[model samples]
Target: MTPPIDHAPTTEARMLEIVFPDHTNHLGTLFGGTALAWMDKAAFIAASRYSRRTVVTARSEQVDFKLPIKQGQLVETIARVVEVGRTSMQVEVELIAEDLLSGDRELCTRGRFVMIALDSRGRPAQVQALPGSAS
Candidate 1:
């Protein structure tokens, strides 16, 4: 079962967006680029929150568009920090689409983002090590 959107555990971030006409493609579905952008933002937030430091996206991987989100639907992007290394974290992001009228929802997209924590001088800095990770 899917967890509630408002339930954010540690190392997790959740964001919601309404799909307007401007965010849609010519076919009236949410634009792929826009979805990716949102997913990246969520990943950034999760990584930053998990490490409590500045973080930057180093890579996005295995992005899969499972379903199309139509305009006027609501999109929830949930990001969680799943793995952490010395200075890098892997965030798993999922985009779920909900019909505003019927309250139906589906998982539309998913991706993994790698973020590197940065020091004040903009160099990679150590992040809090996960329990099983090599610090």
Candidate 2:
């Protein structure tokens, strides 16, 4: 059975991280892989919170890097479930970078991830119907 999409607030998640030297590259910009990892983690958190079940990444949309994050900057990733299926969810995540000392923030990257909920046996499991939807 498919799950209904819930109100955005209930299935949203946010995470913060500091861009240290280790998280950047030779040019002092955040590594693409590192950014994708952060985005995926944020999506997982949101999907799990929405489904209340073990979730795994199935796939991700092409991510666009709009701005570069420099070292010493603070990064915040916001993720929310945008759609729901029988056992899968689509989460949209956006990464914002802020100057640690200036508080200036900009959107750095954005992506959508597909996560699947798993049962105890590691098979796909259904999620609850969203608010106002027929279960």
Candidate 3:
């Protein structure tokens, strides 16, 4: 028989979004809150895909914005599970901004989010650990 649904390693997550005028500030750069929302979405995708369960963000670590994302820049966010507990998982998220014209990319944001799995009753629930995780 095939292994169960939760018997696999987590698939890494990558999301891409373009910085538009609507998402920018008077300085013509992406707003900090918008960037953070993208990072949080990336983390949620990673966690939900891994556990295949309803997950919610418990907290996010200090976010660092290394570079600015200007209008028309492409932002790519990558997320991976770095740690796990009985009911929580820590996802490391990194956002990169690229100037498509020049093909230059820089790390723009970095943060770690703690996501908690929830049962049908909305209480903490155990998540199946990654196959080879030390947890």
Candidate 4:
């Protein structure tokens, strides 16, 4: 069976937006890349907030696309810190697309991102858990 969804406290914050024509495909659906970009942005924000230092994407888990997001839909991206090491933070991100007019939401994509904290010199630096962070 699929593992239970983790409902732990997220490290960073949540972001939402309504998909417009600029973010849509020729078929009038949100493109996968658009969603992926948003996920990455959300992950970066979370990691930066947790590390208190500049962070860079070290790796990205393969994205699984579950449904198509239509134009004029509201897209919500949730990102949470799942694991923290000496200098690396693992962020789990999920993108959900909702039709505000119809109140329909779908899981558009999910992925994990590994980010490494950077020092002032732009080199990998040690990271500490932020205040109010869940252990």
Clashes of each: 0, 0, 0, 0
Q: Model 2: clashing residue pairs?
A: none
Q: What is the lDDT for 1 in model 1?
A: 100
| Candidate 1 segments exceeding 4 Å error | 1-7, 131-135
Cα TM-score per model: 0.90, 0.88, 0.89, 0.85
Q: Rank the candidates by TM-score, best first.
A: 1, 3, 2, 4
The 10-residue segment with the lowest total lDDT in model 4 = 6-15
Query: What's the CA RMSD for each of the models?
Result: 5.0, 6.8, 4.2, 8.0
Q: Pick the candidate with the highest lDDT.
A: 1
How many backbone collisions does model 4 have?
0
Error of 4 at 60 (Å): 0.7
Better of 1 and 2 by lDDT: 1
**Per-model CA lDDT versus the true structure:** 0.94, 0.92, 0.90, 0.87
Cand. 4 Cα-lDDT: 0.87
lDDT of 2 by residue, 1-118 (tens): 9899765576899999999899999999999999999999999999999999999999999789998999999999999888888899989999999987788899989999999999
Alpha-carbon shift of residue 73 in model 4 (angstroms): 0.5
Q: What residue pairs clash in candidate 3, if any at all?
A: none
Question: Which segments of model 2 are wrong by more than 4 Å?
Answer: 1-8, 132-135
TM-score, predicted candidate 2 vs. hidden true structure: 0.88
Return the TM-score for candidate 4, rounded to 2 decimals: 0.85
- What does candidate 1's lDDT look like per residue over 5-102, in tens digits? 86557699999999999999999999999999999999999998888899999999999999999999999999989999889999999999999899
